[model samples]
Target chain A: MIVGERKPLDEILEMVKDAKKILIVGCKGCVTVCNAGGTKEVGILAATLRLARLKEDNPIEIDEMTLERQCDPEYIEILEERAANYDIILSMACSIGPQYISEKFPEAIVYPALNTCFMGGAQEHGVWAEFCQACGDCKIHLFGGYCPIARCSKSLLNGPCGGSADGKCEVDKEIDCVWHLIVNKLMKQGKLDQLTQVKPLKNWTTSRDGGPRKIVREDLKI
Target chain B: MKSGSNLEKLLNAGEFVITGECGPPRSADASVVREKAKYLKGYVDSVNVTDNQTSVVRMSSLAGSLILQEEGVEANMQMVCRDRNRIAIQSDVLGATALGIRNMLCLSGDHQKFGDHPEAKNVFDLDSIQLIQTVKMMRDEGKLISGQEMAEGTEPRLFIGAAVNPFADPFEYRVYRLAKKIAAGVDFVQTQCIYNMDKFKEYMKQAHDMGLTEKVHVLAGITPMKSLGMARYMQKSVPGMDVPDEIINRLKGVEKGGQSKEGINILLDQIQILKEIPGVAGVHLMAIEWEERVPEIVEAAGLLPRPTV
Candidate 1:
């Protein structure tokens, strides 16, 4: 799931200060689960903006709408009729939402209200942790079901660097050393030899180093 | 005879070599390197010029190594994966070799969080092991990391060294990490500073049993504690550093003014013990910021008149 957090209210107010008619759009996807950009958050933001504006003697019209999933074009297409009604459209979904909306309605002034953090799931209520780097190659099976590329601070492939102590990372004491966890898990599973085998230099071309990526599925193409 | 470096030659000839460290000054001063090199020039085989050790900005290891070479001292130029990518790393390798640097140490530098610039973005595009293999490829295969061959006789030839930590967590895996580094074409390794002798002995035994010692010369790291505060900070704060309670108690036993002398005595004991340990090839005395005392430490350890091969 794509986790996101709402931009600060002051920044949002500064952004929409010039617009009279503003639409706050929310997503029912991952942002909703993380309590970031759900319908309730959208209502709260709309109310807060209205109060902030009314206090300044400059109250303007504000509208709220929730989409099934802003990342999908089908849901974004529903706003075609009302897209031009507002001077500004503030997307409360992940960054992908505003991108999808702008791609569909090119003339619409679209802005993201939420910062898409990472592709991760809720570790617990109100807490989210990243678990994937989307590096186009997955080696978790060899690492005892942990993703070092996303979890390790150094993204080390061979083994842990000499900075971990008491199972905590040197970068932050609160963060668990992911390699320590991987080594312990592999040791328990009797697969420690997998770590000893020299992992060659990673082909970072599959990662962001290769630049913005795209997929072309001929089988699914019309 | 991969690099025919003095360090390599001494190790290959089965001599217990002594290596010292010279941290580049924070300011852009070549004379500071020259001054530090003066203390370690005749007292040790090669001096390791650190690359922004602990992430504090300093003179680059390349410039420091070049300065050491100009001072008629051999440099084990240290390269870290934190600040540069493969292109810069390869370019620096060529540049350093062109400047007659014969030794290189590959490392995954300390995280930037501990440095002066905590907000700095680290470029760990290649870790220590990968850096070792990359340099080895450039030196031996005459190929760049991109698999493109360099023109004839232009490849960098360097005696590659890597670091190992015997005190880091998952303690049993540290020896295996050394094996992996050796498999990656590292010719030798200098371990993290050793204070917990029991743990280091166990690590050495494992390496010896695995025949990793035969494959790579293992240089045990030695840092003489300057004060009780330094020992306490290393024990409680520094990761991967195992400063035992016994060591701290020993430091506590000494007067504040005498701790440095006590520290040297402790280092002498460790060096004597390290020499007898199987698979231990030499001692890499860090003596951080205490370069003036390196000659005294080397002499006390009976490593003077360093072998000239």
Candidate 2:
């Protein structure tokens, strides 16, 4: 799931400094699951911004709305008629929300209140760890279901670079080397032979390096 | 044959090559590099120039290598993926080679947190292994990684080098990793700083068992720990490096100022043992911030009057 965090109050204040009326739009998709742009977070953020503005004698007229999902155009259409009623729309969702809202409602001034981080899931209650890089070429099954692209600091595909030590990545001791994890799993599963063969240079066409990717489903196409 | 680099010539002739390292200064001033090069001059075959090592802003390795070239000291320019994409990397490769740099060490540099700029964004478009493949393609195939053909007579014939750490984890897989690099067209390898002789010997035995020792030159890395404090720091803090407790104890046994001397003795002993190891082709001395002691250390290790050819 995509994870993001609320941008600082100062930056958000700067973006909506001239606005007297603001609409805070949250997403009930990945941002909601990550607790970043959920409805509760939207209420909390709206209150904080209002209190901050009221204390400065510049009261902000704010209203809260949580879209079922912002990335989809149909959900974003719910706000099309009301988007022009405010000076600005504060998107408390992942980067995709503001973009879709802005693209759909070109007349609305959409500001992303959250900084989109990565596609990851929660490791624990308050901790989220990145697990996928969306390389589009999913070969995790080959490495015992571990995604080196997201976990390994170097993102080495063939094997661990010379930076793995004590099962920790050289980038930081707290971080486990993804190759170490993969090799351990492979050895435990008696699939250690998979490592003997060096994987070829990754064909990056499937990656964002080539450009933004697209998928066409001919089977479902009309 | 590889761009007239003396280090390559030494290794090719079955000689134990001795290369040193010089980290570029944070400032643009070239005097620090020149001053450091003075100690290593004629005491080592080639000096490895670090590019933004540990992610601290420094005078680039290319410019520092040029400065060393002016001092009659050949440089092995180190390139890392933490800062540049393929465009900058390929462009810098051509630029450095045009400026007369013959050797390049490709690496996935240390992450930014180790340096002053921890919040900076990193561009690891290609790790060290891929970087080696890119350089090999450019030099041998005369094409960019994009596979675009270089203009006639535009290829840079470079002696490619990469770093390996026998001390890193999943020790059993380290040898096979070296084989992958040889297939990637790396000419020589300089390893991480070594203090664990037993483990490194085991690592080398596996490389020999895999028959990789004969295909690529392996230069064991040796850094003289300046004090017990330094040794302890490496054992606890430095990643991909291990300093054995016995060595730390040995340094502790020495008196205050004598720890550095004991450290030198320990490094000399490691070098001697590495020379006798079957697969070891050379030793790369990374004196770290202590570059001035290189001349004496080289002289003591019987590697003085570094080979001229």
Q: Which candidate leads in TM-score?
A: 1
Q: What fraction of the reference interface contacts is present in each model, in order?
A: 0.75, 0.49
- Expressed as tens digits, the lDDT of each residue in A67-112 for candidate 1 is 9999888899999999999989999999999999988999999999
CA deviation > 4 Å runs, candidate 1: B151-153
Worst 10 contiguous positions by lDDT, candidate 2 chain B: B167-176
Candidate 1 residue-wise lDDT, B141-194, digit = tens: 999988899887788989999999988987988888888999899998998999
Q: State candidate 1's DockQ.
A: 0.78
- Superposed on the true interface residues, model 1 gives a C-alpha RMSD in angstroms of 0.8
Sequence-dependent TM-score of model 2: 0.90
Q: How accurate locally, in lDDT, is each candidate?
A: 0.91, 0.89
Give the alpha carbon lDDT tens digit for every residue of B44-139 in model 2. 889999999878899999999999989989899999988988889999999999999999999988878788999898877777888888998999
Q: Judged by DockQ, which candidate is best?
A: 1
DockQ of each: 0.78, 0.51
